[model samples]
Target chain A: MTPQTGRSAGPGVPRGDLPHRAGATGWFDTRHRHLGDWAFVVNRLSGLGLVAYLYLHLVILSQLARGPEAWGGFLAIATSPPVLLFDVLLLAGLLAHAFNGIRVTLLGLGLVASRQKALWVALMGMAVLIALAGASRILGVTS
Target chain B: MATLLQTPRPGADADPAAPARTLRVRRHRRGDSAEGWDRYTAPVGPRTTVLDALTWVRAHLDASLNLRHSCLHASCGTCGMRVNGRDVLACVTRLEDLPPGEVSVEPLRNQPLVSDLVVDIESLYESLDGVRLPLVRTSEGAPGSTPAEGVGHLTRFEDCVECGLCVSACPIVASDPEYAGPAVLGAAWRLVAEPRDRDPEPAYALVDGEQGAWRCHLAFECNEVCPTDALPAEEIARLRGILLRHRVVRWLQRHARPEEVQP
Candidate 1:
């Protein structure tokens, strides 16, 4: 066992069981508190998801330009079992993306303070709503 | 000739009052190939400002002077120019407030100079559009009922005015073109931080990718130069923290429910 230090193993600590500390630095200076790192990642992922959805939706809608026969054919294929599974995955990603945005908004605006539970509930609620709407669309329920 | 002395008349030019100091301003005349400073002398009063002195110059000395000033107050934000190499609003900056005879004025930096003082600000508008700075409103207001209620944190993050000062002041944009400047980030933050903006996770992910929020070195210069006091660096930091938390949550959820974890 390597000597136990006051810092947590930061994804690369080998053969050492160190007490977890929030931040650590070399002997000379302390590490800077960079809380914004996660927001940056989430923004990128969600943005990509949104962009992909926009493009995919546009491509799927192109059937209209090809006439009603093309549209009906495309719809038939989209409702297949494999496609429905893919749609569920897409819906999950979409809901996650949207909820993450809500979390950022909450903290950024100084509202809801630091209550993680409340934020989670709000995010989960949005996901449920989206999932419900997606299910209705998938099941061919009339408006 | 017998000695005869006439009493000097002290009525016209002499007075007991203290002499007023003359403010000499450096002017860059238009149509002059070499834009150099020309001294414009003005009598200073107790409430005189740099704008007042420049107004005097334009009125008395140079009729063809070129400059822009609207609502000689801080509201318009149009009077932001370089004074002694620092950005400040000319209307509010008093001449007496600064060191005497040590004043210089120049147009805003890092923008296309249109003639003398005005710059082409249309590029800023275009850049804003590039970032898609729009309120992600829900499908049209349903009759009198409000659009689908946004999450709890949406309203406060929507207060950005797109002043361009933050962008102009950002060192990142100056050095890296791919680094979407502070103005863009601020808008992104507003969306990510808004409860009404639907899914902020995607926005967060967007900023985390290459040449995005990670590119920002936490210089705090953008926050310093922001006239609106929007603490953009802090906002960026918060956004990053939220993203990390999201990852942790995902990891925990996946680990706890292996069956729920999708392939």
Candidate 2:
């Protein structure tokens, strides 16, 4: 859609604001942002991913209602390498959301207010390490 | 996507004879439904600021170009604008200090666009009004710190210049306009921290709700962009602490025996 009077937006930028700050886009725009802002973006994106995964998980579980044959067929698809890779991605999203969520909780309760930057780095570091371990386990790279 | 320039240190602009720079400035006027960019070549020196280049373009290239400034220095905070997606004072931000390339200049976000590079900052002042932010600040009495020989106390203007930079940079303000932004929240914390005989309850009442300190998702973008180093997010957290303690005290009062409740 044409969002400006004189200028047409570039392809894939269907929702540019009227010569203003990118409103909802700021949630994903990390180019000009700081560590805390990136953390918020990561947390928001991961939260949405986890919610989607939850619904997908429930729908997959509903296959059990179709009897043993259908359940067995679905299990064949579920344990495939592609599905396992998707599980690794889901694990990473969960770790990012959960760890950053803890950091946000501390901030909201007025704890460690001054050391926020340091706190974000520490928490995100833990999230990365845990995500790496989870990914290796899901991909069967570890014995 | 607009070509954004990388931020550079101030000391890089030591040479005087710099090349002509490209300024891709945002353009709009009254009754316009949307806005667009206009590219202009500004012949500039090494020390030439974004304000200087824009003023030059206005004088020679495009007279219709509208912008606002007064102090020329950063003290007035009137020349605030976004250079390459970053909020800054146009007068103080030199073009050369930004990485060499085409620079995109836009009006500050989260404020009513007046036209071109000017934004109406009435919301900022209106938010400040809720807390009645004082101009001068009481000094901290650090050990061995002394005032001037003839002076009894040390006082100065608070760090916040009411520039609205923090508001413009805030992601919460972008989503929810009613959210009291960092500038005002920081001002509120000042009153609560040092009541100086005034009741801090009113300030507490203004920012204790969902639209206040609690709404801040801890982006801390305000702290990053504040030219004055106000540490607004930190102040908001501290304000939340005060509000929490106040609520706990009132809850205790209500639960106590009628005669035992402290006045």
The lDDT leader among the candidates is: 2
CAPRI band of model 1? incorrect
B69-138 per-residue lDDT for model 2 (tens digits): 8888888888889999898989989988899888999999988887888888877887787787643323
Error of 1 at A142 (Å): 87
- In candidate 2, what are the lDDT values of residues A1-143, reduced to their tens digit? 22344344345544423435557876677778898898888888889889889999999899899999989999899889999998888888898899999988888778898898899899889988999998888788894
Off by over 4 Å in 2: A1-21, B1-18, B135-157
The local lDDT score (0 to 100) that residue B142 gets in candidate 1 is 43
Model 1 chain B — which ten-residue stretch has the worst lDDT?
B1-10
Model 2: which residue pairs collide? Answer: none
User: Model 1, stretches more than 4 Å misplaced?
Assistant: A1-143, B1-35, B129-161, B195-206, B243-263
lDDT string, candidate 1, A4-73, tens digits: 2332324453432111111211111112212233333444566787799889999999999999999999
DockQ of 1: 0.01
Candidate of highest TM-score: 2
